[model samples]
Target: MTTHYLLNKLRQENPLVHSITNQVVSNDVANSLLAIGASPMMAMAPEEMEEVTKFAKAVVLNIGTLTTEILEAMLIVGKAANKKGVPVILDPVGVGATQFRQEAVSMLLKEVTIQLITGNAGEMAYLAGIDWSSKGVDAGEGKASGREIAERVARRYQTVAAVSGKEDFVSDGRMTIGILNGDPMLTRVTGTGCMLSGICGAYLAVGGKPVLESTVEACTAYGVAAEIAVENKEVNGPGSFRASLIDALYNLSEQTIRDKENIKRYHVNKSEEGTNE
Candidate 1:
């Protein structure tokens, strides 16, 4: 799937995305949305979350830096999105890292009708009820691939799932897509996953079979931006990489995503264990 078309569409439409994200990358999320031509509203106050959801085309829920109040707000907005039929994208930031985190993620899932769940390998495995390891607030040690777990959870929940690692995987129970165009440096900086989830929400807002296509395009768009940002050696550190990433996003063009996208996709093999099938 080519990202060029979707990127252009998102830019032209400038969808409004309401985010109930962690404090760690709220600023980065907002900036990434702006760079990609989407308008973002970071509304945490429970009093206004429902109202905010009413206006947004889609909603993103992240648990990187969760608070009781933030969780409460998420419930409000998530329900509102469901009632309005807007997509709800969930980012299980660190599900297996702590009991509290796991419980919170579980609670949220039980309450909301999630349209998508994006996370790393460890988080995806744990959420799928498989044993996994994690390092405080970070993806833990695990042999279960994110792609494998994403497909399972997505199928079970009847929702779209994206598991990001060296190769990112996106699935909606039937089709499974693998995107391989990101720079490893993305992991060094915080909130890239969060930003990707927000971007996915933006794509969901646009509507169509295009939702999955939009997600694949967004991932490629981000990877291409990372590739472009790392082209210069002098700016190698996180600080430089951060700015360069934003600049890359800001200057991203349709041709660039289409030209640089390194995505491979196929159907799952039903007989294979722990495989997308």
Candidate 2:
């Protein structure tokens, strides 16, 4: 029941998403949106991005694999998205890995107002201007709590921030949520994080009170799909995990989110711990 409530809203709306993403997962990102009932538009041409973003519900910028041209497109699109009051999601993939990537993300931030920022602990810490020990694209093996990282970034960016780890933590600098229904196998796949950002774009299009709740709903749906995928994998590896994950998203029902949903959230000012807190 929970799945249909959100999915139906998204499908019925057929929100258009503008993405300036990495080449590595651009196709996968586009496919994920279609599976979840959203329309995807890949607009990377620097000249057309501004025009394309004007009509989109939201814009997503990712730096998984960077290029100067793509960076230019991102800034242009971001500015247009901001001008139209459309939501923007920034995903800094492997942000701490190099000066080039960090500089690129910094440039975009200076030019546009991002609505939601989602990344692993390491990427988020780096974007928040903290020196987090990281290895490549994956989040640092260190035990930096997702909640701590998300809160710091959200407050710093003045936007909703999400840090995904064993358990995902989402906050808008004031309210926080911890989602714990995903499986470790989710980490074995590529583009899952990227897809989550795209999912967020879809929810943002639906327009909820405060917008942050729309983001939380998207993350909950992604986590629930991961859990269901793991159950259906039956001891399979990442390949099977990927297929099952898509199936779970396509088959998600409202009853599952209402009954089996494991998402927990609370206002930050309340001084709570965990989702219930």
| CA-lDDT, candidates in order | 0.83, 0.82
Over 1-277, each residue of candidate 2 has an lDDT whose tens digit, in order, gives 1233666789889999887777888887888888788899987889898679767998989899889998988888888888889999999999889999988888877788998999998999887666678898888855557887888788777788988888888898777888876788878888889989998888888785465677777888888888888888364899888878877887876667666667677567545323221
Q: What is the TM-score of each predicted model, taking all chains together?
A: 0.94, 0.92
For residues 1-277, could you state the per-residue lDDT of candidate 1 as single tens digits?
A: 5636767777889999998887888999999998988999998899998778768999999998888888898889999999999989999888787787888888988999998898887878877777777776577777777677877887777777888889998887667889998898899998888988888888788776455666777777888898998886767688899888888998999888878888888686666434422
Candidate 2: how many backbone clashes? 4
Write down the TM-score for model 2. Answer: 0.92
